[model samples]
Target: MQASQLSRVLVVGASAAGLTTVESLRRKGHTGPITVLGEEPHAPYDRPPLSKQVLSGAWEPERAALRTREALSGLDAEFVFGDPAVALDTAARTVRTRSGRDLAADVVVIATGVRARQLPGQDDQEGVHTLRTLDDALALRAGLLAAERLVVVGEGVLGSEIAATARTLGLDVTLAGPLAAPMALQVGPLVSGLLADLHTERGVRLRLGTGVAGLDSRDGRVTGVRLATGEALPADVVAVSIGAVPATQWLEGSGLTLDNGVVCDSRCRAADGIYAVGDVARWYHEGLGRLIRLENRTNATEQAAAVADAVLGDDRPYTPVPYFWTDQYDARLQVHGFLPADAEVDVVEGDPTARRFVARYRSEGRVTGVLGWNMPKQTRLRRQEIADAVAAAPAH
Candidate 1:
């Protein structure tokens, strides 16, 4: 079906990706009916701020709104909030909701995103929390306000950010993870080592290089985190920032490929008339010659645009240089493209000691990624290198 030929569009998961798909379709001159199904009762809101601004009380919950009420109303899309999609029939292009409503559309875009992974017995503990949704952030903020000491499990981006935000909010925060340093797997050793210093200098304790055993609770309230080495770190509140898994439970029997996420073609199409966007999509990357899924906020809109084009009968492959940014303490880190664990990183611009620099990552003699620390403009300029490298890469 062509753009104008699409009779009705159904977007499952009304977060950033789903909402953007709706907006993009309309912007691209598709006047056909659009319906967005969301699991959350709230309108589509940004998720990045939930870990920092919302958690620190710096920004009101409403400030994270991706679009104002008037803007959303102007979109002319029917939004069914709080109705989670429970089942999908790819053959019929129909989605059955938890509320027993079957929404059928000519095209169905899956943007259900991912849910935060939790430690064992996390839900049974009162003080143990995971920061994924808006409600989780608010509840954690409230808990932090009353707590004195906080232990953040999993020292990745989310865990590090949560520790930074909570520490800024006057909580004695300790970050624990199995990695050698925070974001070790993401940004690699050199930068993650610097992150360790940053966290320590900011009074955030680091309990790295150890795996979490479980939560120790008293009276159904979390008291501390037990490490694999039999060491325990006491906490008034515990935040688990372990990774997340793609939210594809509803599509289990839908006959669509589901690996770490909904596997799709290079154009983000899972099947005929069915596509996926955002973190829920593990689409083939022609440039990298592999299936990749990005969990950052940027992918939500970028992939949505790609899927929108695909739905409109555009055959261009949806290959993009992945991008993500993180703000912790006084540092803002930006990354473009892939950063393999063994990638050789070099200071391309500015000095690392100054905490304002750009690092370029190369693997197998090919520029694969760029890292920017507090230099957004220069980093963006350097991003062209990654783009050029991606273009030069031979497709499989």
Candidate 2:
């Protein structure tokens, strides 16, 4: 399809990526009809603050709003809120909604994102929670205030942030996860150890190296979790941040390759006149020479802009350096590049003992990534260096 030939563009989500796509299209001189379909009843809101500021009572839920009512109205887009795209026909270029409404468009952007993963029998309990939506944050915040002991059942970014915020609320918090150390996959062993020490020093108990076997409940509220180690941890509240899966079940039999996410080309194009972005898209990366799907907020916006460019006839490759950030207690950790859980890392600046440091991750003796623990300026300065190193290094 040609850029000028485009008429109506349908965005299947109302989250960051989808809204940014709508904004980008307008900014790029696309004078076309844009309709944003949202599955949630509430307006689009920032998600990162849900686990930290919103839970800690530092930021009200409304503070996470992405745009004001007037700002959204200025975009000149029709919003079909509280309805989801249940199916799509690529040949017909039509999307079927849950209410049996058929909407056809000249182009489609899939930014459905992901949903929180839950454990078996978790819904049988009441006090258990997950922090993904505004309602989830509100419920968890109330549970945090009323509970004496809280167990966060995933030591990843969400769980760690919630544990830290719970600690600030004076709740006896325990962090349980399968990882040997917290955030080992994100930063590195050195920084992970530093984070572990920070949590321990803040009076948050760590229960690492095992997953939850089962959850115990009484009177419809979760009491505690039974560990795989055959030990029971008591808790008055539980937040299961086990992770999330792409919300692509609606695309079943839609002829899209569905793996961890909707598979797309390097340009973020899934099919003719179709594009994917955000956590629901697993696009091939020209720089990394691999397929990557990132869940970070920055990645969502970057990919959305790239998709918008693609829609407007920019044939450039959509490759961006992966970046993510997490705030726990008073520390803000930022990372750029891919450092898997098993990636070998060596500190190149400062020391982890000082509560501030920078670590460079290397694969096959070449720097591939860098992480900053309160070293924002230094880390930002070294990004170019790492990109150069990655370009010069031999492909693995």
Candidate 3:
């Protein structure tokens, strides 16, 4: 079926990606019928703030709403909130919700995103939290407010950010992770070492280079984290940020290729009339010559636009420079393109001592990534270097 002839489009996730798909469709002149199915009752809201602003109490919950009520109503789409998609009939292009309603459409977009991963037996304990949804962040914030000591498991972006927020809230925060330093696997050794210093100076205890073995609890309340080496770090509260797995379990028998996420082509199309976007989509990258799924906020909206264009018969491949940012204390780090762990990094501008600089990452003498530490403009300008390099590289 052609784009103009499409009768209905069903989006199965009311996240930034899903909502953006709806908006992009309207903006691109796809005025046909559109339906949005959301598992959460709340309207689409921005998630990046849930960790830093919302959890820190710097921003009210309402401030995170992606669109005003009137704005959402203006989109002219049917929104089915609080009903989770339980299954998909790929052949019929129909989605079955948990409430036993089957909705069929000309095109179906999966933007269900992902669920936070927890350590074994962590969920049964009280005072243990995972921050993925708004509800999770609020609950964690409440726990942090009443707690004195917090042990954060995982040294990735989410865990590190939560540690910074909790420390700012006057909690004695201990960051535990298997990596050598905070964001070690992400920004490489040099930048992560600097982050280690920053967190240490900010009074966040670092318990790195050890994996969390399990949770220590008594009377159904979490007490601490047990390290792989058998050392126990006591805490009044614990937050798990190990990572997240794509929410694709419901697609188990749906006949779509599911490997870590909903596998899709370079166009983000999973089947003839179905597409996948956001964190739940592992789409092929023509430039990288492999499948990639980014969980960052930027990819959600960017991929949504790409999928929306595809739904409207745009044939261009979705090739984008991956970008993400993290705010810890006074430091705001913005990264563009790919920063492989083994990539050679050089400070191209500003001074690292002053904690304001733009660094370039090179792999095999090719500019693969650029990082900005409080140098947003310069870093953004440096993004073109990576883009130019990618354009010049031999197609894989």
Candidate 4:
């Protein structure tokens, strides 16, 4: 079916996904009134560097924005900042912002991205922080500069990066998580074990298989965290980043499926006249025959492009491979494609002790994913091979 020529398109969320969707719409010849609403006070910007560059105080928040006002103004798209979406009236085709303004649109794309999951009863305490937005990073960075003891909760990509960053600032840092190692979900058990060893060698306390019960605070400032085992880890600051939930609280009453994230077909379309993208959208994989939600920036841009095509009468679904990267303590790790839990892992080159290598994950002799440490070129080649294989697979 040919999509109606979009005249009034409202994109809620001004980050990578929302901005990309609007830009794609304009590039595809949709010269309608496109209004982009962002809860962040700043315009859309890049986020990958927030932990490495911005948190180190080497870069400012402006450097992270994807597009400047001049670039956005050139497209004739209206930009609204600092007003968070409070509710969505899908039936009325309007959205209500916290500022008491109603935004009407012929089509609405929800790109309200996820935020870092904060610890309950601790998230609001001073010196306890979560890093997702620019403001969050600024606060955490400030704390890190003066902090003597830093406790990072979670061994995921963000948490590891934060631990590395804290150590770079000469802070005594401890990395703790529920898992036995770091990046176990993606790089698998073996690689995660090596990573734990690397952190320990660098004088960073790697506390694995432990979970936080609560944050101990006095006078509204965090003093330490209590462990699930009834032990205490004293810290001047704590950063919790277990995972992120979709920013779909405003669409709670909207008549669309909300399972973990907004469920959408390949093209990013959800309910009638509505679409969801970024970390907030759960996508259906035809090959895997399952719904998957990805938090990578690449997926966000690809899905946003698909959303633009869907809006312009194209039915192309986002079927790209998932890829992510992390930088910890001078080591760079990159991965492409999804590796099944049962997949066999192959250590192609480099030893964990040497700290540079390529690993390939395969299932039944067919490559499923590739992990690279200082071998980005090889990783990309293997990833492309997997993508080709998936595309060439026969129809069921």
TM-score of each: 0.99, 0.97, 0.99, 0.96
lDDT accuracy of residue 43 in candidate 3: 95
Q: Least accurate stretch of 10 residues (summed lDDT) in model 4?
A: 1-10
In model 2, which residue pairs have backbone atoms overlapping below 3 Å? Answer: none
Give the Cα lDDT of each candidate.
0.94, 0.89, 0.95, 0.85
Q: How many steric clashes does model 2 contain?
A: 0
| Each candidate structure's count of clashing pairs | 0, 0, 0, 3
The candidate that wins on lDDT is: 3
- TM-score of predicted structure 2: 0.97
- Model 3: per-residue Cα lDDT over 17-45, one tens digit each: 99999999999989899999999999999
The candidate, 3 or 4, that scores higher on lDDT is 3
Better of 2 and 4 by lDDT: 2
Q: Candidate 2 on 94-166: residue-level lDDT in tens?
A: 8999999998999999999999999899888899998888899999999988889999999888889999999
lDDT tens string, model 4, 145-247? 8789999998988888888888888889888888888777667887888888878877789777878888898899999888898888889989887989998
Q: Which stretches of candidate 2 lie above 4 Å from their native place?
A: 393-396
Q: Which ten residues in a row have the lowest lDDT in candidate 3?
A: 387-396
Badly placed stretches (over 4 Å) of model 3 are none
